[model samples]
Target: MKISTTAQAGALESNDVLVTVMPNDQGGVQIQLETKRVIFKQFGKQIEEVVRGKVSEMDVDDVIIKVQDKGALNYTIRARVQTALERALASGTRD
Candidate 1:
């Protein structure tokens, strides 16, 4: 799938994650992540893994994902990413 516009889901509230997605003209998936300093040291890789996994699963080849995590679980992260991607897809121009 291709992301042709910017979209977002979730919130910055505690235990939730804010996910933003946009088109990447560079032709690859790029992710920018943010979280608490302490939590990043421990679970940053895991959180990034979940995001990457979801993007891969959706077959999105050219997009940028920005994740702001507020101590969210893996499921929450996945859901937020999926929702953002779905919205982007829906808003994109059809080929």
Candidate 2:
């Protein structure tokens, strides 16, 4: 699935992640993640892996994902990204 426009999902609440999805002018998916947790250095790679996996599973490509992580668990990240993608696709369809 290709992202047709900019979209977002999730909240800034604790233990949650806010995800923003946008169409990329270039090729392939680009993920930008931000986290303030002390364990970020250790868990950053895992977090990125989860996001990439989720996007690929949705068959999405050539998009930019911006994530603001608030110490969320892996499941939370997955859910947020999924929800964001769905919202983006749905909105794109409407337009």
Candidate 3:
């Protein structure tokens, strides 16, 4: 339900969804989300750049997000962020 320590401290992987993780210079982390869209995918990169936070930053670390998306919608992206965060939380290990 919350961001798992393993997920937070591991690499990113995906099958249908493109997963990517980059360690920030600061002791923070971020998860970027996007559907299979040319334009949205481009913006997703930028979103990753600005998005920054630690699991502790969230008031509660007990949540996972699963987004049903067609193209990369802003709402969808946000949903995916939560979904992926949740995925990371539940996932025992980050591969």
What CA root-mean-square deviation does each model show from the true structure? 1.4, 1.1, 8.3
Candidate 3 regions with alpha-carbon error over 4 angstroms: 1-26, 30-46, 49-71, 92-95
Worst 10 residues of 3 by lDDT: 7-16
Candidate 2 per-residue lDDT, tens place, 14-95, comes to 9889999999989899999999766578888899999999999999999999999988899999998999999989989996
Residue 47 shift from truth in candidate 2, angstroms: 0.5
Model 1 collision count: 0
List clashing residue pairs in candidate 3: 1-63, 2-61, 4-89, 64-86, 65-82, 65-83
Off by over 4 Å in 1: 93-95
Off by over 4 Å in 2: none
Given candidate 1, what's the lDDT at residue 37?
A: 95
What TM-score, computed on C-alpha atoms, does each candidate reach? Answer: 0.94, 0.94, 0.36
Task: Using TM-score, rank the candidates from best to worst.
Answer: 1, 2, 3
Could you say which candidate leads in lDDT?
1
Model 3 over residues 1-95: C-alpha lDDT tens digits? 23443222212233223333322334334344444576455665554432333233343343322222344434434443544455554564554
Worst 10 residues of 1 by lDDT: 86-95
lDDT of each: 0.93, 0.91, 0.39
